[model samples]
Target: MTDLHEALRRGRARARYSQDDVGAALGVSRAMVSYWEAGSRAPNDRQLSALARLYGITPADLAEGRDVEPEEIDLAGMLLRADEEIDPGAAPGIREFVDFLQRYAELADLLGIPIRGLAQSPFVHRAKFVQKDDVRRKAEEVRSLVGLGTGPIRDLDPVCELLGITVYRAPLGADLRHAPSGAFLNHPEVGFSILVNLDMTPGRRRFTAAHELAHALFHSNETNRVVSNGRGPRESFADAFAGEFLMPSEGVRRFVEEVGIPPRIVDATDAIHIQRYFGVSWPTALVRLRQMKVVTADTYRELKHSVRPVSLARSLGYSIHPEEYEQDAGLWTIHRFPRPFLRMLRTAVIAELMSPPTAASFAGVAVPDIVQILGRPHGNAEQEQPQVDTEFVEFEATGVI
Candidate 1:
């Protein structure tokens, strides 16, 4: 094999991506990956750039047939290498996610959409280690900065987006039974991005988003990336942040008062009310109550073991959205990607800045579907009268055109 071919093969092996994974990610066929590795066919410039990114190597390293030296590794490359040793099955998905973020940023730039920076947020902090008290304080500060005023953050996705943090829901891999709830990355190219596992329930997904937002706001300076599996001091701090940010202690107290329950004697019914009121999981509500000393240890344990949150919610006349409590509800749905990212992708395709095939791949749709939504591209509208599709423009404003 030629050195370039050997390099390509080595890079794929190092990244632990199967040819099928590479093919699916690149919108190409497995046979094409094989031919590229066998030196029978070469990839074009766009494909080469994508391959280099997927393999966590620079295009120059691939061309020169050299390994990426330790000093030369980018944040995404370092994270991929770390994950290979930690969770091999998750490494491919992580690489794909990073590539997706990079592509999103690129499209935004091409379309002249301003990419928001972390420094732009007045609440941004760079503390390497945060105590529980510090975490609570920071959460409160962030809530105030965002003007949430201790309310049950009905939706965290929009809040994160408003802070310039891109949030996306995608499958990390079914095999990752112990998969991380979510991950965060801070790169010069992508700014701040969080990826939550679509296999998680909506409540858990929201919690994970808040958890990663903590990382994005506070811990990003310590490391360029973090994969939160809910262990260790940093993970603990993130959990505390999520709890305080979503269900503040004062909010919990006011909620208990509103429900006419004594704080020290809160029961399962009270816990259910808190859970539904705050839009958190049952266990999360119980834990917060315990932390706040509203529920005694005995009561907390009893409620934790006895409560069937979803069934209980229904019995109590609370309408439960299955998507909020059921795992995998968000998986393989139209909402797989963040709406903002899809909007930009649609805009790029409509503006002819991105080709239909590429835009389709990014949007997780078929090429024909993209064409059907955005209409055909006219090379020069000035030379020829443009055929305006009012329907296309209408769908763009509605969503995911």
Candidate 2:
């Protein structure tokens, strides 16, 4: 009985799976698996291999008791989103598609886990920063202090910069929005940041930034986990913040009054144009318009139903984004990670923090495919620790604090 119990506990947590759940998946009795994990016994070599495969991890990782990078602690986490039984490895056809959405949906609210948007993550802020300081309240004061005046819509970057928030552009996964730390603000430290799925529309990104900001301000005090349910009051508050922050009600009302434009403007570009003036996404603009009842529900439906998203260069001109852009040329989402992080990774060998081998472990290309999401950056940074500004990257800029 070589401390198998501790090993099993670590294994279970690392895999994000429950003991009984693993037992059911492996067609073994819960007691049997328990005994094996508890060190009273060990799984047979074949059984061990089976369990490792079930978790989509190497057997060595399980037996050696290595800390699966926070990102890999996803096997069990997937259950939150899976609408059906999740098969090991990738599934096929519609089953795979639904499973993917289910997992993504599950993560929408579980923000504490790793929903990294880029190859490298922003630096994970330590609890020490917040424990000695009253960070959350300070953050709230900071936002209120900013008192972003009521005005025409504006680009959000300046505000992010003003607040010392750094936005990270993450490759899109099934997860809709992300901020990577739980104690990101328990005391008011500053190493954590928010990461947005670059693949989302400007509309969605605008809302995501606001939602993340909410986490930084309000839930940053939550020392355990983070995730957003896109439909809750919490989310509604973020949307409201994003709307107000991007396009103040005063300005919006004034702009509409000035233009004397009523619900009849059938041109989508006009909507996009207005969003551009405000530095928001087309969808965000449309949704704002819809929310204001600026257009009839039928008109709103015509626009929402018109969106056809794609992420290839050849299709760029012919895609939904372009069509929407035709409606408003300023509709574009900005990528946050930029080229700097990769440069930091290259200097790693000099720093000696990451062994060449260790660095390769979390290499750029991994499961779920990173390239499909972030598009191609100038270069990939392998075996490098992500250096993100947690305050902004971890949550939205205008979310409830």
Candidate 3:
């Protein structure tokens, strides 16, 4: 294992910042930065804090050698680092997310889950989409591959996991406001990874996952990395794919027929009903309704103006928010650690490969919480034999009598 000094050097390298860059950011001489990294000098508390901020890690993570080695920086060929590919403000969140991906790969390897994903496939088109024709066809192909069978996908997570794509949610905050709603990367270690911004509605998140998956299958060849950030030819194609994938044209038509609604949807309640039934956002369902000609464009416009899904769902006594699951007490306390990952950690602790403290640290919880979860004694066991304190002198020994 590397020591604190090596860790410091590696942290800078991982950040891909030159000594001069670090020094300029800190208002110091490049030679001073080099000396500190070379172990000839040590940084004061303030310098250490600044260094930690530059590296986007806690000071303790640097001092304890918890930072990734420089060699591991581009091990996955991070596309998020591509110049001008992503917003500059979002770089930090992507960097932190990449670190989490590294740790996830470690845990998955320990758990022996086969690392597989849709890489740059030969079946993917060499040329970009000229029209929605190819995009819609590819969407159908993906659906068939996932055994979607022209039906509404009940859950997105299982579909992603089945396709060898790992999906994780990152909480919404000011830090991630500029970050892309979803990003796709083809990792050398993990194959393909998709990150969904948890701040979006459940329907929106599902769409984002599907959108990124489109990038993974078709756009992986375009670049090793793609951020599903905004509107463009590529993004437009992905949007078309997501819409088709979630609400198949045939499926929507059949659904409208089954519901026996008139050609025009007159009530907002009917639109909300269809939205909930298909497990899609109200906007998606409304768009599908218009696309299938079940409702006129003017009707769609009117429904969009009058309907608020969350408020309607609450009035109907249903959980309309996708993020509500995170608030459940039964879930693992750490928002970042999914249930399966938590189970893997627990298994490692039970098998004695990891200490309770170590597992607790990884989970961002108290040690006793891990102990209790593992059904182990929270306190240390009592010694079989008690030892006498020699420093406690008896009255006879002290001649006090």
Top model number, TM-score: 1
Q: Rate the local accuracy (lDDT) of all candidates.
A: 0.73, 0.46, 0.69
- On lDDT, the candidate that comes out on top is 1
What tens digits encode model 3's per-residue C-alpha lDDT throughout 330-374? 332454444455667788898887899988876557887787667
Which of 2 and 3 is the better model by TM-score?
Answer: 3
Q: Kindly give the stretch of ten consecutive residues in candidate 1 with the minimal lDDT sum.
A: 69-78
Task: Report residue 228 deviation for candidate 3 (angstroms).
Answer: 1.8
Model 1, global lDDT: 0.73
Question: Per-residue alpha-carbon lDDT of model 1 for 78-146, expressed as tens digits?
Answer: 555433334556666676677777777777788888766463335556554676688778998888877
Q: In candidate 3, which residue pairs get closer than 3 Å at backbone N, Cα or C atoms, i.e. clash?
A: none
Q: Sort every candidate by TM-score, greatest first.
A: 1, 3, 2
Model 2: per-residue Cα lDDT over 100-157, one tens digit each: 3233323322322333222212223323224212332333343455666555435554
Worst lDDT run of 10 residues, candidate 2, spans 180-189
